[model samples]
Target: MDESSRRRFLALAGGGGLVAALGCRASGARSELVKPLPDALFIRHGAHNAETRLESLSPGQLVTPNDRFYVRNHGPTPRLSAAGWRLEIHGDAVARPVSLTYDELVTLPSRTITRYLECAGNGRAFFAELLGFAADGDPWRDGAYGVATWTGVPLARLLGLAGLRDGAAWVMPVGLDGDGYARPLPLAKAMMEDTILAYRMNGGPLPMDHGFPARVVVPGWIGAASVKWVGALEVSTREPMVPANTEDYVLLGADYPRPPPVLTTQVIRSAVCMPWPGLLPAGRRTIYGLAWSPFGAIARVEVSLDGGHNFTRVARLIGDDLPVAGTWWQLELEAPPGELSITPRAVDEHGHTQPPLSQQRLNDKGYLFAAPVPHPIRFV
Candidate 1:
């Protein structure tokens, strides 16, 4: 990264920690994770979830530090060593069932790609806090996502090795944590070259807070589809309506389409690096933030000083703008004293931009809230 780029990205790293968990508070299921939760880097949501503090993103640091990445667990993080790890591939859709030990799995051809992993409910808090649309689950405010370089065997290679038979419609990766937590992926997505069973994160062996031993890393899809501590891949001829899919990630709300659309690829989203509710002294400064999409690279970013009524394109973009990955940007502006709200909206390569606040609606689970909402600030 260049000097100018590094400084732009570092501006977001200056804020203090979030004072509270945005909206509703819940003591969800207990997590068995043994990793330490340092207050400076994370905002805790009960015992199971630890949200990454966006302000911790340092200058020129594109790959999220494994230790600072967010943790969303349904159960406890299991203790598994590579020597004892085994991956079972089976189901009616596989012509031949196969079980590969960790050693055997790593011997296969592997690929590395940098992409962002984000929860389907990453911005759930906006629903209730901004739009008055009540949502369930932990109230996350854009911290449930991060970018990482993942190295692993392409999932297609594994399926091929197991003789993936014709007529397979879904691939469900089951985890070793809590009742084998699993979510189904369409066979087509599972066969995509970018989909992999990753064993390394940011060039290091996976951390326990992440998936130790191995985990699924499905690019361009919701994070839940990338099951951690994976133990088995269950190929099926039909959709596997597990709670992760049908009950949880599925869109729920009176305004949504009937049958509730099951979330697949994530949409365009962006967030400023400063504090959620920031206070600043009157002056001129450069604003920094990151924007991305599952469909493509960000085409442009516009910031609005007066809520969502008006917007101006960011002064410059920093770093490589890879598809399905995020890029940092900076905008120079003059500030006046008193109350202010800065809202950043991103446009993707597909011509998709954030919905206006007028069009925002609540999903039953608060799965996707991509509309632009103001980031309140006080300029003293």
Candidate 2:
């Protein structure tokens, strides 16, 4: 849809009871239709694109601001009404099927967690730039991930209230925005302590674009596992056969046969946030960036100045050491007058290091690019 038509749709959707459902007065203004994103945000690929610029990561709190957080929408953002919304928990494996309203969910015990949600296809552009074979999907850079403080009730708490029948093995969360946008998770992962039905982001009510009434926040997993605009959940006795699990998110490559292992936890990765192919004053310069891993906390980040050649430096971790999964690092060194290439590699607490670009596996979908990304720079 064109920009004007898109705006009109949003305006109509919001003014037409969607905002009222969420217990808010709908403003008759265009601004109420869609939240304006920051001007520096990049349009990686999409009709209604939402992505963060690499430079935006610097000089920000560890928890990304709600407006600056990256958004990956498979369909247009649905303007939902919380008052009319109900999360239905049902399936053959549920002992007591129940439908929960927004007010009822918020009255339950709540908890907060700071975690990063990263797209499995993040950094897919590096595949073509470095390996010469482009993946068939959104050509994302390193900005497809964002860290946030998510607040909600533990999903296990709700499942317990509903009573899971014996032999329940999978939990499938379905969205309200589009058809077949649901994904399933093993019961074990679904019942994890950090798995929550989040109604709030940062500190306020969840934004419409970020899954207003509620959404599932599956920590340490790929972003797809956390369904936005969550409306219902299906607890099944057998593995879910949804297309998201059986087709899209699974790895497919030459070595792996049909239906390779389904993607779960995000891979360890790092990216250079500064000095992006521009002239810089020759002297002392500090190269800084963000690094994260799903397995554990980032143990170390290595910076290579000349395309993994002779000079390599280990960056110093900044801020309080994160005992969890994500942190930032910075490296200070003298830069002589010349053009240069900078690359960063992160090692997680589990000893999993970022793979070199050449060592990355070739998947039909280009799902995960966990290799060190090279950034060009010129010292004047």
Write candidate 1's Cα lDDT for 231-324 as tens digits: 7788889887778776778887787776778888887898877777888888996777788889888888898988879986563678778788
What is candidate 2's lDDT per residue for 10-41, written digit by digit as tens?
A: 34323433444333323423322246665566
Supply every candidate's count of residue pairs whose N, Cα or C atoms clash at under 3 angstroms: 2, 0
Q: List the residue pairs that clash in candidate 1.
A: 32-76, 252-364
Instruction: Identify the runs in model 1 with alpha carbons over 4 angstroms from their true place.
Output: 1-31
Q: What TM-scores do the predictions have? A: 0.89, 0.89
Candidate 2 wrong stretches, greater than 4 Å = 1-33, 323-325
Q: Which candidate is the best by lDDT?
A: 1
lDDT of each: 0.80, 0.78
Q: Residue 301 deviation, candidate 1, in Å? A: 0.7
Model 1: how far is 374 from its true place, Å?
A: 0.9
